[model samples]
Target: MAYEAKTKATDSSVLEFIENVESAKKREDAYQLVDIFTEVTGYEAKMWGPSIIGFGTYHYKYASGHEGDAPLAGFSPRKAKISLYFATEDTSREELLQQLGKHEAAKACVYINKVADINVAILKTLISQSVSFLQERYPNHN
Candidate 1:
């Protein structure tokens, strides 16, 4: 199923949840991510779906016949780690990923536990690169 933001319910329970994490480190990581995303995307933070903090918007269709609208770029705070969604399983990001500090890649996203584990400069570059990629792919995304 596709994700939907409950616009009518702008509850910030997600922020509270992140703030109340058992570990101070994790909470700080979340805060840093929020700051980085805000600085780069220029979009105020908001919880999308359930655990994701999304930046921008983009509508996408998969070749496998699935179609949906999603954040142009976003991240999810999972139990074990954080997943940064950028490009899908395409090799277009291969070179960039190689320059990344430490991260795991999935079919459509990049996974990391903490911001300190990776280069903030590189992460910012990836965000910009991914946004550009999606914008070029979907010109009407704005």
Candidate 2:
């Protein structure tokens, strides 16, 4: 199957979605993320697709011609881990991750077993840096 982007903001209730998290621990972590992201970005949380909670917004068009809007920062509390979305292309991402506590990072996502396992201060820095990088690159964030 072709890849389809699953990260789009919807009118879905973020609070209700978090409430439905299967694990109590995950649900608590989701609430903490909402508070953290909101405080860091000064933007309200929005439900992205069925799983992700996102903050802020930015639009971009790639050289290959693809174009769309995406959240400046976001996270999803999956059954196994909480997936954090960040601008990993930023040069400082690696340095930040080194201090982020236990995490598994792919190209753009950081997977952590729980929020308690990570440094909240470093998470805030990551979110701030990602927003700054996106704002600089996209210039259409809000």
Candidate 3:
């Protein structure tokens, strides 16, 4: 059997999803991030799975042979924090995070309480770099 990706793009309305976000502040930030990510990736926002608002698509197969498709850059507004999805493997990930404002970095997600908590410029850089890095590695950008 082949592996399947749970976070595939859906036919959901991105705007509706954001509007349904419980927190007014997070909902507003989600809209702002949609603009920033769209401008940076030059791709329209798409709903990935249930929550993630993704910009671009890429397919990846690791050395262990697990493969799946995911967004080049995206984010989800959870109850606790906004989860920023970017390519952590990118060389500039660390440098960009340094310039980013108050945020906590994890293996794959960057957690921020609000968009105002971080520098938008650095966020844009991180999104662009993530797209570039994945495109190079996967070359199967959709």
Candidate 4:
């Protein structure tokens, strides 16, 4: 059987999702992220799964034969923090994260309390770099 990805893009409204965020600050930050991500990636926002607002899409197949389609860049406004999703394989992400301001780094996600806590410029660079890296790595997907 083929591996199935739980987080698939849906036709759900991105704005609606943002508006539903429990925290007013996170809601506002989500709106700002929509603008920043759309502008930087040149892709409109789309809802991925339940919470993520994603831009662009890429299909990836690993050596193990597991494959799935995912957004090139995306974020989620959770209760405690905003989770920023970027390309994990990008070489420049580590250096860029250092300048990202107050944020917690996971393997592929960066968690920020709010947009005000981070450098927007660095975030833009990270988004651009992630898109570029994914496009390069998975040329056919983009």
Candidate 5:
């Protein structure tokens, strides 16, 4: 399925999400993640996949023969944790993640429970690096 971008402004539901969670800690974490992504990717925030606040975007294809488009790097502020989408798995970032302080990685994203749990600077750098890495792999990505 093709991903659809949010055409309307950031809605009240997202705001309600922030308020309903009622945790200053989580709200602060979401703010930090957004700031980190902006600083690294240099792309302004945009709503993606309903809850995701995405940065840059790129087209991609997996070896499994599945191919599609996705945010070059981004994250979602789910109630449980922050999902950081780097979209590329590169060994070069393995060492960087060690320097990133605290975080966990799934197949395509770095998961953080809170911003205080990780080094914001290193996270920003990693996101930027991942975008560059994917761009090298997919030049048409924009």
Candidate 6:
């Protein structure tokens, strides 16, 4: 059987999701991120699964034959921290993260307390680079 990704894109309203964020600061930051991501990626925001607000899409198939579609760039406003999703394998991601200000790095996600704590310019670069990397790696998705 073909595998399916749990975090598929949904028709849910992005603005509604932002408005529903429990923390007012996170809600406000989410709106700002939406604007930044949309402007940088030149793609409108779409809700991915329950919480993620994503821009653009890419389909990836690994050697193991597991494949799924994922957003080129995205973020989520969680209760404790905001999670920024990007191309994990991007070469420059680590170097850029050093300049991202206060943030925690996971394998594919960067967690920030708030937008005010990070450099917006770096975030834009990250978003752009992520989109470029994914588009290059998965040309058909572009």
- TM-scores vs. true structure, each candidate: 0.80, 0.94, 0.94, 0.97, 0.77, 0.96
Cα error, candidate 6, residue 29 (Å): 0.3
Please provide, for model 1 over 1-142, each residue's C-alpha lDDT reduced to its tens digit, 9 standing for 90 to 100: 7544342114467588687677788788888888888888776777776577777777666676665556667787777888897763356478778877788987778888788889888788778777778878877775
Model 6 is weakest, by summed lDDT over 10 consecutive residues, at 86-95
Best of the two (2, 4) by lDDT: 4
Checking candidate 2 for backbone clashes, the offending pairs are: none
Candidate 1 lDDT for residue 128: 75
Evaluate model 2: give its lDDT.
Answer: 0.90
> What are the lDDT scores of the predictions, listed in order?
0.74, 0.90, 0.91, 0.93, 0.73, 0.93
Error of 3 at 106 (Å): 0.7
Looking at model 4, the pairs that clash are: none
Which portions of model 4 miss their true places by more than 4 Å? 88-90
Error of 4 at 78 (Å): 0.5
Residue-pair clashes per prediction, in order, are: 0, 0, 0, 0, 0, 0
Q: Candidate 6 residues 51-133, lDDT tens each?
A: 99999999999999999999999999999899999884546888899999999998989999999999999999999999998
Two-way lDDT contest, 1 vs 2, winner: 2
User: What 10-residue stretch in candidate 1 is worst by lDDT?
Assistant: 2-11
Better of 2 and 3 by lDDT: 3
Instruction: Give the lDDT of residue 105 in candidate 4.
Output: 95
Residue 119, candidate 5: alpha-carbon lDDT: 81
**Local accuracy of candidate 2 as per-residue lDDT tens digits, 89-127:** 656898999999999999979999999999999999999
Compose the digit string of candidate 3's lDDT tens values, residues 1-142: 8778888999999999999999999999999999999999999999999999999899889998898888999999998999999985646788889999999999898999999989999998888888988899899778
Q: After aligning candidate 6 to the native by TM-score, how far in Å is the CA of 86 from where it should be? A: 0.6
Write out the backbone clash pairs for model 3.
none
